[model samples]
Target chain A: MGTIENILIIGGGGMVGQKLAHALAREPLTPGTTSALTLMDLGFPPGSPAGARQITADVSDPAPLRAALAERPAVIFHFAAIVSGQAEADFDLGWAVNHMAFWHFLEAVRQEHLASGGSYCPRVVFTSSIAVFGGPYPEVIDDGFPPAPLTSYGAQKAACELMLADFSRKGFLDGIAIRLPTICVRPGKPNKAASGFFSGIIREPLNGQEAVLPVGTDVRHWHASPASAVGFLRHAARLDTAPLGQRRALNLPGVSCTVEEQIEALRAVAGNDVVALIKPQPDPVIESIVAGWPRNFAPERALALGFRADADFRAIIESYIREDLAPEQAQRLRLR
Target chain B: MGTIENILIIGGGGMVGQKLAHALAREPLTPGTTSALTLMDLGFPPGSPAGARQITADVSDPAPLRAALAERPAVIFHFAAIVSGQAEADFDLGWAVNHMAFWHFLEAVRQEHLASGGSYCPRVVFTSSIAVFGGPYPEVIDDGFPPAPLTSYGAQKAACELMLADFSRKGFLDGIAIRLPTICVRPGKPNKAASGFFSGIIREPLNGQEAVLPVGTDVRHWHASPASAVGFLRHAARLDTAPLGQRRALNLPGVSCTVEEQIEALRAVAGNDVVALIKPQPDPVIESIVAGWPRNFAPERALALGFRADADFRAIIESYIREDLAPEQAQRLRLR
Candidate 1:
């Protein structure tokens, strides 16, 4: 295993990317040793590490990315992607950033590795998603889902996975793609993601605001906490892929729960007053998107590898309260 | 159902394409009527119907194909493809012919239909193959089997299926892809296809010549007669895809049999003398290719739609002798 002396996090400005960077900064890397970290985004935000080098360059452009990659970092977390909802809306932009950008990066790494043969190849951990699944599914999906993606975004991701597999098979780069479930209680204001409402209802209520729940109380989905998502990425980066052999992509396991269960968890933590903040509103667009998504996935292979999920919805709510909210806000849930 | 008054056969000079052209010509179209045919290929073979037209052009170049498609024939049979073995061996050729060429054609058709306000959408019947399936399979594969294609050819075909589905969904064109089983008792000289030896062992032995069976006797595979394959394409073109609705691709059924069963059919047809002419020569290259293919597929969807395979191995051999060989050659099957 190569020492991850200097790791670079691409798309660092995004919520998940930023959280991952923060988590890594707090991690104690292999006792009695340390490594420099380089974080890149369109712009550097507050709370980033002191003296941490930051670069402003579009990850979609190959020239600038090649320059970033020139640092020859031991680990690269490629978290850059146009989200599913946005990708579906803008076909051209989605193709450029989501698909072509990934291909260009992989090709660059391949050419570099060929030119400079050595003992170490950079580890590339990519974030795939459960959006890759579509409707007409079994109650639980498995590794062999035919990738009959209903939307262009899912197709693009599936296409990227194929390219990554072929490139890895050609022995160019050590690539790992983790198909993350919908991240619950995302620590931010609401975004355009249709599924964002799933987190919105819970997050907004905790922030003392009312939020709309677009679907019925019966709608269920698979979810992972931001911490678990970051853990999934780091574990994927460090795991021995030899056992995985030919299969480089994985469907990371997650907690599956219904809307009713989520609301119950919210009440358990923040009391009935907080739970009352959620109002049911039906939107066909959001319902269609949610409907097509797999409610749960039995990721047999990923589970076998020991990746964990939120213990329960209550644990998930507690995580948001403990890890994200301020001390004063945490005290609101102290009784629980 | 629309009547196939004027039929256009693209890539007409190819093996399957030519065979299909002849079969259509030899069969009756509708009562007291015949199709006005147009054959398009890179190089048109010598043939002239006083009215039938021929166009010579490269499919990769959209100019000629677009000009030809301007006529808006009622039915289009697309049998054009670079075979799997050749495609896997050459990357550029594979992408250009198998992938890009079809995209250009689809775009052209989409533009035409959109311009005409859907008044002039021609039914497209494209031929696909069983090479789309890969290893790690169950004893009886089903329609739900994921397309984890092992070769670039399979990937291209899978990609085409996606494009076809998208185009059909958008109402740009009416399309149907028939994933054909490997045609057994293929009547011709040996070719480069890895699966060619499967047919070669039977076809050559029936002709009173020695043939090599490169794979072991236990190797099982799905097969259909050349006649059945033609019927599949024709039926697909005329079938009402309205019920197939949106899900435009169908996996045509095929008879599943082991190599030993195939040899037994040949013996049953031409007696011990012909069977004695067979030689066993294990080849790892062919073995590996055959191993990745799906030996059987439970095509309930296709069967429900009225597509049928050869009833048995004996019937497959009998059809080959009766339909492909001369009367004198058919009479030589003394055991029958």
Candidate 2:
């Protein structure tokens, strides 16, 4: 049964949204029926797939959300927000975009559902982050670890997760907030996120260019390919949330390894020459910010729910090289 | 230098709020300076003391909040919300009052602080509840227990607690959310709260009236006298919140006892005539609700921060008798 038809992806201008859009375009929500996608962001996503209508608007404003709710899209993919470093630097903007926008969006959904005689609740896929967890210890943070967000961004995400559970429990909406691991080898120009280096080191080197390595080689963190993140969202959408109990958010499964382990995996796949393209440059700001983040997770609940991740850093690198990089550019880095 | 002067108590018509209003009216927030009190509720509270100016309005509404904020009260006690049973029965009303209203109030506070040239954040003491914990078996819930509220009321309180922590961290307001225990031997009326029977069984029996005892006598739960609850709020308002990092809410100290234990205490104080007044009339609805509630708490953080509660069930009963009932009523209850 193809339950999903109409789709709405907030923050569609971003990397994960773009990739998710591609995946959904390749496979219809209900095998045979192509899902019409409404993609809303601060800027219209470049090269968005067919059947996707792009809307440019500030997500914090409830007006656009109200208009979108009028169409009654069956599913909503909410990935819109200010990243951690930016949120910490600029508090108000972060609250407006990350917290206030989502609150307003949910309120709009509730209003519409009420107006429809209580039958217009849409399934919402909220992309949370591992930044939502921070602490004094635990080498492997399990699914049950309490969320004690150290940053404003994490706090906002945690708050949103609570709302998702409450709203879903009330039958106002069907929703899941998935805490995504730090996306490794993110294919893009580096932005302002403190965890940006997690991708930049892999991405820049893979592109036959120099990449900075901040912090120590021993720093361990969780990672997943872009494809896996999208897969987690899709799987969560079709999930039987009845078993979720009071916690609506789940820490999605991911590959957990230190930077040294990541480098070795790169060497095995792309050879030592490609790995050597990385340069060492310590940056305190990035180190401190990333240090407070949760190192790894035991995502037991998510794995039980059929969520998956890349087998290893090698698999993650291969996927990025195959999917994100140009073949000619990838071949040059291999030193075969 | 005294930091507190003017005061505002939302939900002032409620028992705890009324008691709080009386306490503030009797003593100054800052010694030698009488702090003016503004009491807001759905209806004007009776006998709310001389300094309190009662405003009959919805506490969740932003208009009255804005009007109150203009005065820049040094301390604000937010004790407003739909009780558990009512919230469960009326979902929409609960969301409106519990969630939306608090959201708007926070926004209003943020706006006021912004408009004040970054100097108008007040000490906000929000009375949260133990309903925030719905466990799958942990003998004693601790300060670090993750909030997984089972009911709509609990969900609302937990969400608000997160917001309080976030807003406080952002320097928007100085806030602390204290999760109060079930107020036992409650004065006046029996409300719709599922845990009201914890009070009803104790109150009615002492008043020489028949009391219905729902659920088994073995069901252990946390309890506090009205005086202790007020003490917690006062201590929270006056305490330096700098020690409380990201987690702003604390479970206030309370006496943990079972219904059988409570009955024994009632007999010791008011004699067998009063103890015999409790008749077992089990209601599955109330039984199930109370069963899901947390049995006891390890309020390590609150106790360490100097928050106190009654030593035992006898102390709780004695405090209620001494503070709430008239002298004639107390004498009659002692005889009974």
What are the fnat scores of the candidates, in the order listed? 0.24, 0.45
Superposed by TM-score, candidate 2 places the C-alpha of residue A94 at a distance from the truth, in angstroms, of: 2.4
TM-score of candidate 2 chain B vs. the reference: 0.97
Per-candidate TM equals 0.87, 0.92
Candidates' C-alpha lDDT? 0.78, 0.85
Query: Which regions of candidate 2 fall more than 4 Å away from where they truly are?
Result: A1-4, A61-72, A111-122, A271-279, B1-4, B29-33
Model 2 clash pairs? none
Q: Is the docking of candidate 2 incorrect, acceptable, medium or high quality?
A: medium
Q: Could you give candidate 1's per-residue lDDT for residues A25-47 as a string of tens digits? A: 77733444355677777776688
Candidate 2 residue lDDT tens string, B42-78: 9864687885788888866678889988888888899
